[model samples]
Target chain A: MNKLKNTFYPLTAPKLFITDKLMRLLLMGAASTSVLVVCLIFLFLFKEAGPFAFKPGLGKLLDSQWIPVSFQQERFGVGSLLSGSALVTALAMLVTVPISVLVAIYIAEIARPGEREFLKPFIEILASIPSVVLGFFGLLVVAPLVKATFGLSTGLTALTGALLLSLMAIPTIISLSEDALVSVPYALKNASLALGASQLQTIFRVTLPAALPGIVAAVMLGIGRVIGETMAVLMVTGNAAILTASPLSSVRTMTATIAAEMGEVPFGSIHYQALFWIGIILLVITFALNIVAQRVLKKYGMMK
Target chain B: MNNTADKFILLSLRLITYAIVLVVGYILFDIIRNGFSALNWQFVSSFPRRSGAAGGIFPAIVGTFYLVVGTIAVSLPLGVGGAIYLAEYAEQNRFNSLIRLAIITLAGVPSIVFGLFGLGIFVLFFGFGPSILAGSLTLACMVLPTIIVASEESLRAVPKGFRDASLALGATKWEMIRTNVLPYSLSGMITGAILGIGRAAGETAPILLTVAAFYLPRLPKSVFDQVMALPYHLYILATQHPEAERIRHMQYGTALILLLLVLGLSLGAILLRTHSRKKFRW
Candidate 1:
């Protein structure tokens, strides 16, 4: 085909086909636009955030208060929000990682074919549920239960936010982890079984290890979703930017800070810059998580 | 003894899986029970009265519809075009990997950050203000990664043999992609776009900082107008309403509508994907 095309190609260099070259370049330009958008996000964030982001020398971010709208001496200490985000994310990951991994294993190794079919779609549907509804549910259901159980002043706490976020992250974890587990070679499991290993042991000792990298990728995805969740956490988290580690404490997250405060802040104000700085931080962290996940998948030969 | 232990472990896993299912069931049941009470046609069609103390979420519904339409317009063409480049044209090299990395990174960026980007670039920088245009562009960027990845996967699913055959029959690569690859992969692409729309409709974060209003309960006159969206409206009612506890049923109703809209689109996508897989099975 190459020879035939060359013979018919205006009797010159094949690359001299201006139309073909132009079309290829057009596609490449469109494709690279995604990269350009990514660059633009980072640049725009930094451009908007740079002045205030550096004014506090980065360590002021560790200050224990976050009163960006004060009558005097506005404090941009994200410590409270950072701690809140950490506390909620830690609790959320603690619940979701185990449950989601177990769910993936069940779907991959234990569930009957009929069960698998139903479970997959059900999970997808669960993922499709809006975060706001989950937030509402947390406010209505989980918050009250937590408050009643713990004898708290209000149900709004890191616990409520974490619980809802864990629910939200589960589907991402289960789906991706299940994909990895499903791709594990059947022959490897069979070999373990033939060696007198129990079905459970084969799954645990062989399949899980083989799928480890992909599972890591899945967990990273869950981490990305959980930390980035805004509405549910914003609603149930009490929005109190307090520097406390207790799950019972009402704390704000970096995301909730932006959403709750950005609406009222004057454009180009220092407060606006502070919020953009938080966004830049989020962009960096999530980008890092995503790149690491992609690298893991590529290394495991699962990424195309 | 080992068999018994394995049985216990497997049983526990299955129980947890069922627990997850039950959790989902409980949420749906709760939403429906409360939302059903306030879901009369009057509530659905009428504008809010008494400063959201009573009446319907009509403007929110309309605004969300407009945003979804605008988002699909912006994302679909670019996403499909980029996917075509990735699947058909790009060589296996550093540049391609970098593009993939960018897509993955874009996908993972928190929607709030996209909200910020939209605030910076679209609203402030481009002077679109807090309007529907800003919100749609923000959402389009956010969903573009999903569309690109899904479309690329579908494009890959189109058998290389088809492309080869087209080329052998004297078709250019562009011709082969348009007539052969695109037609076959379109179902998957549309499925992806459907899922993207669902996400876009359900999203509050991107719009919160870009175009969502605190309580503007009227439909917008143009793309430059700020509008009330369902997710943001629900958020306000759930958390910020001074009488949030009093308007509980109304909040649930809005949530239920948003939930149904999003879930319906996602269900449609899943069904189409299943159908496409069966039809295109090698």
Candidate 2:
């Protein structure tokens, strides 16, 4: 039987075995590339940002002004930028979370099958619109309307940025929250309904509570997206590093600061290092948010 | 009283949903309504004049095309191979879970951070130097997580019976995957790839630092040459141009083209996904 098999298959089992081993190695290498890339990103960002941390010291980051290009003295205080990012993200979340959760609930529970099909794709399309295009819309269309309504001079304020950012973030929250809502076992809803609850009551009392963890995860992810967004905010936020809480005032996010300054700052200069340091901060924030979000989903068995 | 409250709440939800839809519709209508006046055959086919304030956006379109192709080339194989390993080979353990965490983190990394990383690695370390090669690699890294997740889901969707049957018939593991597994999952993989392409094409931040030129209207002869991209082009026109106000028409035109390209890719992916669902039942 061995001789017959050898005659039929000229390529020996040893050769096939070697080929399989090589392929597995190649595939493993490919799989591990993502981990390697993540490591390299942290490494390089820290490498560039390290020098600035030492020479300037981390205290400079706490200063309230961000005049990096001043002729006599350059300040790298990120307080205002941090405040700006926080303000925009906070405002965006304030607007986005309620609307997106409601939309998710509507789609998951209230919409007819045909309406769900129509609305789902519409939201996905909204998600896929390029940020730059939305920024352009904000610049020409929304900015003007905002300026006229608020009687602001420039119209590029935190409010405008927050509104557009909320738009950008809405799709993410809705989709993920929709998934969370849909995953609630029918038994829970049926029980709520059998207990003399209406559809709205069942959704609000049973489904909403069950999906809360997932909804929180979705909102965190949305906040991460809003915080990390660069181009749109840069174009629409007026790029002012002002320490203010008013949404009508111009603000500069850490992301917009890096994007706006990185292009002009000489390589290896303090300004460049400052940008890299900002990159590190952004990376760490988003990383933490993502990890927490994933943990929430995993702990609740909301994600596969 | 309870009935009135429920009616109000449901009515508010329905109104808000419709409002969201209308906002999206208005944005689209605004762009298409204004963009048509600026778009002409000559505008799309001819090269820019006077720093993109006048003339066509041919080079930007071509550059974007080159980028999408390059991104596909670099990412598709790596993503698919990674998916195969994860779906078929990896043991469920701490290490694999760590890999999953890394992918999730990578996906959540901001695009600008990706740009900075690309600058450090490809543009400086590898000496690709602000070129399409650097940009494509950057985008590939950005989109890798998406492709991996999508492809893995598709791979997992194939029934285990097919694989068992092939292996039971005396085929090697690779032979079983090649003959019975991969063919069925290719369409789904392609659908994911298209979604990734849509994202890569639309992203401006990664390319801004790594590859995009401010006004290089000429087509790149080599991957090393910096090329103008659609998103960056619109950005400069809308924000940085000295004649930004004068060039409103051009800005709208560029925005329209980019909007169509990205939305069209997304639409195609959606269609392809539905078609694959209908065709492949098992």
Candidate 3:
């Protein structure tokens, strides 16, 4: 028996050991690819963007007018695009935050069990609807409605984009804030009720305060999404790169500028490089927002 | 008076919730109402004529199918492998923490930025030249975080006793995971991958710069060739086409198809997840 076992075991054990080590190495390499890709994204964006710093110079980005196609000269100001993004994102948050928070409250606190089950997945379906379709809806349906309602010559305005963006932002904020509200320990609610607090009072005074950090994180993440959103804004907002604070006016965002011009711009030209520079700006802003949100979640132990 | 105020507030919240639901319902209703008329067998099977104002959307449909195939090919193995490493092997350490951070950051990076990265790396550096290969690679990166997170969650859900039993029976670690862990977690992983593919299918920004063609009415002969995707096609039809107003029916038709594709995949994922939970109770 010992001799048979020795012969059988020696042949397979070493082979299995070798394969196990190899597989682990392969998986580790696969896991590390994300890190590598992140590094490459940073490198490539800066490499392509580096040329603009020398020719048009970084200072040119501050100019308020963005006219890449012109007869005599080109202007690569990113200020207008920045303001456009800010205007749309601000308006979208204004609309989304209140509605999402209330809906989240209803889903987590007020709904019956069966209703919660149905509502959660229903909202997820809303989340799953493609942004491009949303953009299409905005273009054909919402844009016309806006044009008629506001007495504007055109339906395509910053407000039109804002409304569509609000639709997109709603799912994200509701889901995350719902998770926050749900995670608030039941014991706290029980204690609040035990103190003779009304259901509304308990939710507002106890649950909302406890889940504030997660809700804030959720809102920040939603804003990150709005700021980075491209196609919907590109379609709904009239692609005019002019600085304006009015929601009723046509404006172009940083994302829209890149998507619109990258197709037509000559490769390796300053215009091309400027688009990459804008990409870098977008990368930095979204990265900072994500890191901050992650930090908040981690600090509050709400990451799960 | 306080009770009356509380009652009023709760009622207002309920009304607002229903209104949000109504708005979403209206959007879907409007699309189906308008788009159903334009969708036909001829429209689905034929190629476009007159700058997409009059032809069928066969080429765009085929292009999106190819993209979904290619994205699944590239992302699934890497994402699942990454998940296995994180869930089964890695210890608590700074390096692992950094990898987690990278995954989170990757998830939050804007889709347009992904387009730029794909343009710079695959198109420019690797010389794929804005083809399906480049676009698939770009999308794989974008959706990797979702797959990894979901897969790891499922992997962790398998009972520790199973792993211990396999080990006690003299099975190698890899053998144990292969036979015991992966089988159970596969449905969850596929659900995550399907969701990722859905996102890839709907994405226009990343493909806009990497792979999508403006008016390619023919099917791509190879991965190197650019093709017309449904989302990008819808964008062109709705906004960029010179006869955008005249082609309103076509725009709605494309939107309907794309919406059905994405939402159908998501619904499948949700259903599969529920079914798996029922089947794999332990």
- What are the TM-scores, per candidate, against the unseen true structure? 0.95, 0.98, 0.99
Error of 2 at B146 (Å): 0.7
What is the Å distance of residue B64 in model 3 from its true position? Answer: 0.2
Using lDDT as the measure, name the better of candidate 1 and candidate 2.
Answer: 2
Candidate 1, residues B139-218: lDDT per residue as tens digits? Answer: 99999999998988889988889999998997778878888899999999999899988999999999998998877767
Off by over 4 Å in 1: A1-22, A53-59
Query: Clashes in model 2: which pairs?
Result: none
Question: Tens digits of per-residue lDDT for model 1 on A1-304?
Answer: 9988868775753554565677778878878878989999988998898887567656666678988878888888877888888899999999999999999999998999999988888876778898888888999999999999999999999998999999999999999999999999889999999999888888999999999999999998889888888989888989998888899989899999999888888888888888888887777778788888888999989874
Q: Candidate 3, fnat value? A: 0.82
Chain A TM-scores in order: 0.91, 0.97, 0.98
Per prediction, the TM-score for chain B is 0.97, 0.98, 0.98
lDDT at position B82, candidate 1:
90
Residues A130-183 of candidate 2: C-alpha lDDT, one tens digit per residue: 899999999998899899999989999999999999999999999999999999
Error of 3 at B280 (Å): 0.6
Tell how far residue B271 is off in model 1, in angstroms: 2.1
RMSD to native for every prediction?
3.1, 1.1, 1.1
Q: After superposition, how far is residue B207 of candidate 1 from its true place, in Å?
A: 0.2
- lDDT per residue for candidate 2 within B17-79, as digits (tens), equals 989999999999988888989999999999999999899999999999999999999999999
RMSD of model 1 against the true structure: 3.1
Error of 3 at A50 (Å): 1.4
The digit string of per-residue lDDT tens for model 3 on A45-160 reads: 99888889998799999898899999997999999999999999999999999999999999999999998898888777777788889999998788988999999999999999
